[model samples]
Target: MPRRVGRVFRPGSLADVKGRPTRNTVAGALLLLLFGSACAAHKGPTSNPRAERELASDLTRVFGAPVMSQGLWGVEVKSLDSGRVLFEHNARTLVMPASNMKILTLATAAETLGWNFCFTTTLETGAAVEGGVLKGDLIVRGTGDPTINSRNERAAAVFDEWASALKAAGITRIDGAIVGDDNAFDDQGLGAGWSWDYLQYGYAAPVGALEVNENVARLTVRPGATEGDPAVLELAPGSGLQAVNHAYTGAAKSAVTIDFERRVDQPILIVTGSLAIDAQPATRDVAVVNPTIYFAQSLKDALIARGIDVTGGAVDADDRGDLPAPDARRVLAQSQSPALREIATVLMKVSQNLYAETLLKAAGAAQGGLGTTEGGRVATRALLSSWGIPQSTYVQYDGSGLSRYDYVTADLIVTILARMFGDPRHKDAFVATLPVAGKDGTIASRMKKTRAEGNAIAKTGSIANVRSLSGYVHTRDGETLAFSILANSFTIPAATVNWIADLAVETLANFTRR
Candidate 1:
């Protein structure tokens, strides 16, 4: 008989995680105390149940007491072969997935648009330059390529390519304005239910058909040479942002608390707080107001550096689904983003919000000719519906799961994982994207010294009061299992909740069939 473990231990509080405490508070703590004592007495697997009996015991022990009171968890684990369900606890309950929602978004993208799909950005002109002068605007169009960043290219190298191509096409000077056209996708910049707090950061960068450097401006801040002096500020790929620094340099040993904020309903970048004299320079990446205009201006600057000056300034065309007709002139140069599989890998491994949103809009654009979130939501549901995943399992709200409104069941996540494994065409490409426990990506520090180390591939998610992890694991008995564990409405520390979830996965990895 397995010994009953009656102890309920809670580690840390949720007060440390920025923007996470709103979901957990004193009221939540009171609720936890009320029901935790009762939940602690519950049992699992009354009879002898093979490998899962121990797993149930472990989960039962963890899900009891004060920790469980703070948050509700939905967990499900199923065997790929033999069609056996290993464990289930509130598997059908809808919970916040956070960034783990990327699993479905990435999967849908890879399936709807083959893994090899590539987004293209092209350069065209309505009128060709004669004698190094063009009378009309130089139009640059993008088809939802998320690359064009410093990671892939350096120092506007790609834009320099565009400039060279323009010169090669017999254009030494652009006498007209440079126009940026992103009509391939709709004008919807932010996701549905996205709050302004999220829209100001790079992670919540506005999505567009054309994006450069992730549509953000990096603000580097360095303390002044002496105390009581203002800190120095600089913006990279600076286009439409204006930062007002109200920060001051403190003593060499003074406490450092550098901060940046955008006041209520204002587009201004307000910098505050303090920095030490000897402290290293820090960077804050903020989302730009307009990505299309930024792209246009960036190219304009690049052309100027390449000795091609424009008589007129950059033009955005205020693309509100009203784009000018394509020019009859031939294209001068083009830039192609990496294949969809590569982008998917980054999206899952790092849980990138910008890339996920871009892919979501791309899906809608592919299916409905409009890359709006609604269009993507319709197509995403249909794509999963075709795979037999019901609409009831999830409520589609936004890409990247940043919105608090996004909800999904653990059972649905496991089902999707199982189906993806069965697909021979995308099994390798899809699974490779997940973070390997104690080895790579988001879970690099998870499940260390346990059997699950380096053997589990999963997606991790975290928000205010939410934390989740879901993916595939191979048990000691050589059975492949798909699992999803989601938690919401918790008042405890997010790390402790994550530890409980990790223990559950480790138990699955160590399970024996015999």
Candidate 2:
């Protein structure tokens, strides 16, 4: 490592479920459908009485390990094929689910928006383009397109394409501002019950209709040439925020430690601490403030970089008045995001929080309502109700489980699994999104070479003292199983809880009726 700190900043920063037969709540009712209808219709992979007892014993030992003694655990495992509850402990208790919340968010979105739904972001203008000059403000209207981010592409690729399209259309200069119309989503950016400390990290990024780069900017810090010299700093998407470097290089081979801070009322990020001259460069991503403005400014910079003349500066539509109505605008450029299935894959595979939130708001907008978190919640609640899953089983404060206020029962999670697994409309697309054990996604390195390896596909969740793993696995006898394991208030390391959960899954993968 040549100590390269190539960050985007001059200074920047960085569920449950259970089963069966109760009609008042959908959790149990859905279980009956997965089980009862199957038994009445035909023979499925029935659970063996002796095998169930052995599984109970194995799971008890796995969860009873001393590492889990201090934590509160909730788990449920049921056969989607046979419709029998294989194992459950505290399955109905409400617990914080972390990113597992994305499951519910994506499932509802897939149902509401359909598999092929795509988000369209457009560049519109109310004035004419004459003699290579755009006479008025160029507005960018977004419909909560999460794929506009640079998770796997250049930060300015989308904007650069738009500028090229403009030049090809004989538009070389803009006479007015480049305004961002992020009105599709509300002004509330941060999720409910999120801690203030999380504001500086990229994962706690704000949500907006015009979000770019996932509302995050990376900060890179490198050691100076010699000891006691000021540390070098850089930021990506450098148009938005400013960085104040207070860090210094230390002696060669010394330890590297750095801290980033942004005061409550300040617009600048102050980087403090030191890095050894020979140490590798460090990088971190930090959330930006007022993401709508960030998106507008970034687009403005991209246009300028592409040899386009921008006589005016970037502006957020919320800060301006006298804008044209929707019908009065003419589109100059547009970007269509990948379909919902692809978007949902990113959401589940990496557990992208902004994606979950963006999709939720988009769902609300698609339902003929303003795209607000409350509206999203209403849409999701209605969807859950339609499935007969009782609203009392889960309390969703935000699409991502990043909010500590979000809670759900193991029973509810399994119900979601069973429903998605059994849904003819979304089964393949839905299950394909989960991370595979010992193969891909967040759990790529877990359970390698074990019976669970490549056999378990699940969503993993973690936040503070909470840890969760819920998904599906196939047993040795070829029985398909849906399961959820949640551990909260644990004193042990999160890896310990994950180990126990992985062990439990491995145990399930090893089960055989013979």
Candidate 3:
């Protein structure tokens, strides 16, 4: 008979080290206490009779922790290799998905729009260009491309390219206004159910058919030389916005407090607060009031800087009454964004809300008739229905989970994962977009030094009291598992809930059926 090698302790038991402890004995106990879960990660086959029983009990204990008892949880884990349910808890219940909603939006977009899809923005004009001069407006028509941004001077770089294209086409001067035609997408910039308070931040930047620098204006605030001195401020891609600074420099080592107020449909950005004289320079990116005019004004500046003279001012197509018919206009220059697969990678890895919203509208225009939020929802619903997912199981208000109205079930999330896993065309591309544990994207710093590190890939969601994790992981025995963990209405700190979810994923990553 084999001898018992190690002792086991029940919860809160110290019998294993009851006697006077030796130096090695105390060290070993400390190691065990610190890495108890890491040790259990090397356990036997997760599906074996004994292992499965322990996994169930372990997972139950984890979700049943005192802090989690008051919260609602919807969890589901399954083996993709054998199509077996590994574990589940309230899997069918609806819960806030937060950024997890991007999974569904991106998956639908990948299938409906195809991986090679790209957005095209064109510079068109209806009038004649004679003697190096255009007789009418230079219209910039946008097709919901979110790539034309001013981050790191990228907008100027892209605009320089456009200027070159224009000069190459024999367009040295424009006689009319620089107009932005953003009719491809509806005029509603903000998403449904988005908080009004979040409007002032860059993350909540408005969505539009014509996006410039992600529809945000970057501001650099420098402290004045002395206390009570006015703070210095500068805006990037400076156009269509007016900054009113009421901020001052504070005493050395003082707290830095900066606040801004820019109401919707307004161009005046009121800056108020104080920055410590010794504080490092501060930077803030605020949402622009109108993306169309922003793009138009930016293009106009780029054109003038490139020696292409424009006599008229910048304006939106809707604001102008006399616009040429679509058929009568001719394309002068155009810019095509990167492929959808690359765009999806950025969207999933960073959980970019603007990209999510734009992709939804783009899919709507591609499959349905119009490029609108509701159209995207209808298209997504149609796709989900084809996969046998009932509409009652999930409610999608916006492509990005920014909408407080969005809700989904753990079952729905896993079902989408399983479907994507089974599709040969999209399997590799879709999975490549998720954030790997301790590797990259939003979860880069999470699950480090654990079995899940470099082994699990998932999307994380967080908004107020809601936290979610859902994606794929390969077990120790090489069996692939898809899981979803949604926790909502938790009164505890978000880090506490995140710990619970990470522990659960780490458990799955260490699972084996050897």
TM-score against native, each model: 0.87, 0.89, 0.88
- Give the winner by TM-score: 2
For each candidate, the alpha-carbon lDDT, in order, equals 0.77, 0.83, 0.83
Error of 1 at 448 (Å): 2.3
| Model 3 ranges off by over 4 Å | 1-47, 150-157, 236-244, 264-268
- Estimate the TM-score for candidate 2: 0.89
Please give, for residues 277-373, the per-residue lDDT of candidate 2 as tens digits. 9999998888888788888888887888888878877788988988998789988888988899988888988889999999888888888867988
Q: In order, what is each prediction's RMSD in angstroms?
A: 10.4, 10.4, 9.4
Provide the clashing-pair count of each candidate structure: 2, 24, 5
Clashes of 1: 2
Over 208-313, each residue of candidate 3 has an lDDT whose tens digit, in order, gives 8998888887788989988999999988663457889999999999988988877566777888999999999888988887889888888888899899999988
Q: Against the correct fold, how does model 1 do in TM-score?
A: 0.87
